[model samples]
Target: MLEQGDQIGFLIVSGTFLTAMMGTFIVAMVVLHRQRQVQNRQKIDNLKSEYEKTLLNIENEIQQETLTQVGRELHDNIGQLLSLAKLNLNSAKPEKQAEGKEFINQIIKEVRALSKTLNLDWVEEISMDDFIRQQLHRIESTGYCQTLFDSDQSFNELSKDSKLVMIRVIQECLNNAIKHASPDQIQIKIYKEDSLRKIDIIDNGRGFDTSIQSRGSGMTNLKKRMETIGGSILLSSVPGKGTHITLSLAF
Candidate 1:
């Protein structure tokens, strides 16, 4: 009961409608994809900004700790040496003059070494292995407890930000062992496991029960810091045996 011309017109209209609907759907999909991309980029930018801020804070803490150490060394070690040197010079006998001169040279060497420590630019220049060794040496120099460090290989490819966080975490573990636990032995181990790098700090110290201990021991901060770097921390402890902390990072 329809005319040929009318049927043709209806077919053309149906095709146009279908084409428009497909175009609209495709356009909508493109817009949605673009929006998601923008959102993801913004999220990444925010995370990067946060990481930079955290790294800055860690650097500041390192500087502060370095200053404290320098002050203590000056007051305790260098001051006594200089005092002795002055006394030696004042009592300058002909035979002892050469000895005093030698002592002064030794003092100069120590001062130079301390100066190197004060220049924290080495933080950026040093590799992970060097950094960990430097920290362990500091503990060994203190003469209170023995420290052992073992690593599979140098991790030179880690980002400075990751290194900062890792160093802070290790420092915290060392401090906890030295201050609270009074450990006689502390050991640090670093190795690669599959796609991850692992750092373990083990101490034969008086460790408290992780379940009963308050969170103020900085375990929460450690966990959050590791999470920010897309890593995780595991703490294991026994009441009298020891404590072991493991940090795993996806490099």
Candidate 2:
């Protein structure tokens, strides 16, 4: 019953309806995909929490073992060696006093060397600068990144928890660069910006598109860690340009 023109119009309407239906399907798919991502992230967070607990337990065990070893070495080796050195000096003649002094100096040097490898208990005796430098030593040994840490006096003023979080976040950043970015240089700077404390972790390496997929599990874990302590993280990265991670923690 329709005219030729009306028939063509009907076809056009049908095509438009089909296109709308396809768009609606695509939108639904997108929504469902996002939901899946949310669920996956929740699972990852749970796993990360378990991982942290395990990490703490392992670290505690290693520290206990380290202290035991140090105690044994001090008692059986260094302590006895020092006593022997002192006895040698105490029983030495005037001509041999110089030799005893040389031996004492040698023993002192050995003690200083052992002091470098002494296990540190962060929960007890950790300074902010020491923590940062400790992380730097870890990243540098990997040979993939050379990281530098600079901080203002405000860094020392932060709470101990904040200091620990900052160190841990920077540690994660460096781990990502080594494990993923393959960066050659990474520089970390922490200072006060107004009422908040800021940490900047900059790396000169091949970056990636965060819009696509963030392949750095370390970064995602780092973000969750920061958020647990009432902090936030911002990442600026471009393909081949490099990565800059900025963390802001409240007082």
Using TM-score as the measure, which candidate wins? Answer: 1
Name the weakest run of 10 consecutive residues (lDDT summed) in model 1. 92-101
The per-model lDDT (C-alpha) reads 0.85, 0.74
**For all candidates, what are the clash counts?**
0, 0
User: Tens digit of lDDT per residue, candidate 1, span 1-251?
Assistant: 57988999999999999999999999999999999999999999998887778778788888888889889988998888787777777774965666667778888988887888775666678888888888889888989789998998646677777778888888888888888888888999988899988989999998888889685848887787788899999999998999999899887
Residue pairs with backbone overlap in model 2: none
Prediction 1 global C-alpha lDDT:
0.85
Clashing pairs in 1: none
Which candidate leads the pack in lDDT?
Answer: 1
Q: How many clashing pairs in candidate 2? A: 0
lDDT accuracy of residue 24 in candidate 2: 100
lDDT of 2 by residue, 1-251 (tens): 46988999999999999999999999999999999999999998977786566446445554665578678878887887787677678874875666667778877887776675465444336666676777778678867568788887555665554555665666567667777787888888878887888878888899988888755476676676677567889999998989998888776
